[model samples]
Target: MNLETDLGGIKLADPVVMASGTFGYGFGYEGLIGPGDVGAIITKATTREPWAGNPPPRIAETPCGMLNAIGLENPGVEVFLSEYLPRLRKSGAVVIVNIAGRTFEEYVELASMIGTAKGVRGIELNISCPNVDMGGMQLGTSPDMVYKIVDSVKQVTHLPVMPKLSPNVTDIVEIAKAAESAGADAISMINTVQGMAVDIETKRPILGNVFGGLSGPAIKPIALRMVYQVYQAVDVPILGGGGIMSAKDAIEFLLVGAKAVSVGTGTFINPRLAMEIKAGIEDYMARHGHTGLHEIIGAAIL
Candidate 1:
């Protein structure tokens, strides 16, 4: 089966990609899976400077998902380029750097820096990080800000820019269109839905940040709906995910029009989930007599 696909100008060997943050710079599970196992690897959300992140109790489990307020903790871009980039390049997987910034200038700075970095294939602008105060979902909630950030980042980087959209919005389609109009090459949909959990015994919140983003099976239905809606609203390709635990879920995103599907929280449950999902997709294609991914992408639209 032809699992190869494209996200804007960046071509992939397959449509299965590891979601940012969950995979931790793409080298954490090298012992379990190979670089060629998936289409590409998106590094954790990095900022202009090193981040301390949130306090303890940053993660809490829910009914079918989990809430995390990890606060975008990272070693900063300089350390990433000097250390992580070299290791990532050596792995031989296509590298898409996911970056977050406190301001428009910071976002542009990050793009400009990564644009020239060796072995970097694309940039996933993380405008939807709900854990931090300065950046994250704060900048993603406004359509105007989304347009400006994407536009500014585009001005500096020749790499494909994908602005991850937040589901916590009045209208996700409007935000998606803003990114498209601002020159985003592609878009990543359904960044974790904003949620929180409280401790009835203590009569207090469970997370260190009080509120956190929810991910896993609980958000899959809502994520699918957003991806389908954004597909019709924008012409750009989409990287879709949220509660995608298996190949069936990934296929659902593809039928709804996602050119690629990101495997996030699912990895926590199964470190080899990306490879498993990829194999399952190929198996399904063979069973259905489909030769290429395009044959099924958006096949449900009619």
Candidate 2:
């Protein structure tokens, strides 16, 4: 079976990719699985300057899912370019860097930097991170903001640009179409849903940020629905993910119109989840006599 596919101009060996944040800099789980075993590696969200992140209790476990307000903690772009970029390039895998910034200028700067950086194949603009006070989902909620940010970044970079969409919006299709119209090569859907947990006994909030993004099986149905909606709204490819824990779950995303599927919280549950899902897709393809992934992508629409 041919699992290879293209996300805009970037070529992926398969549709299974490790979501940003959960995969670190793309080398954290190197020993567990070979770089060639999966399609691409999306590194953690990096900012222009280093962020210390939130205070204590950044992560809390809830029923069937988890809540986190990690606040986009990272060593910043300079550290990543100087230290991590070279190592990831040597891994012989396609590397897609996920970037977030506090301002429009920072976003453009980050894109321009990564666009010329070696070993990077694509850029995933993280406009929907719900954990931070500035940037993140703030820039994602407004369709106008989405268009401007994406357009600015596109002007500076030739690499495939994907604006990750926020499910927190009233109409996700509007934002997806905005990104597409602004020259986004592709779009990724369903960043963690905004949620909160309470310590009823102590009458306190569980996370230090009070509210956090909810991820895991709890948000799968909602994510799938959004992907389907965005598929019909935009002409660009869709990278779909939310609470995908198994190959079957990934297939469900594919059926709904995702050109690729990202494994986020699922990686925490199983480090080898991406590889397992890749193998499972291959098996399913062989059994059903499907020659390539394109056969099942958006097959559910009819």
Alpha-carbon local distance difference test for all models: 0.91, 0.91
Candidate 2: Cα lDDT at 25: 74
Error of 2 at 288 (Å): 1.3
Residue ranges of candidate 2 with Cα displaced over 4 Å = 129-137
lDDT of 2 by residue, 227-258 (tens): 99999888999999999999999999999999
Question: What lDDT score goes with residue 150 in model 1?
Answer: 93
Q: Pick by lDDT: which candidate is best?
A: 1
Least well predicted 10-residue stretch by lDDT in candidate 2: 128-137
Candidate no. 2 TM-score: 0.96
The sequence of per-residue lDDT tens digits that candidate 1 reaches over residues 1-302 is 78889999989999999999898987657588777888999999988899999987999999999999999999999999999999989989899999998778888998999999999999999987442544344889989889999999998989999999989998999999999999999999878988999999999999989989999999999999998999999999999999999999999999999999999999999999999999999999999999999999998875
TM-score of each: 0.97, 0.96
Q: How well does candidate 1 match the true structure, expressed as C-alpha RMSD?
A: 1.8
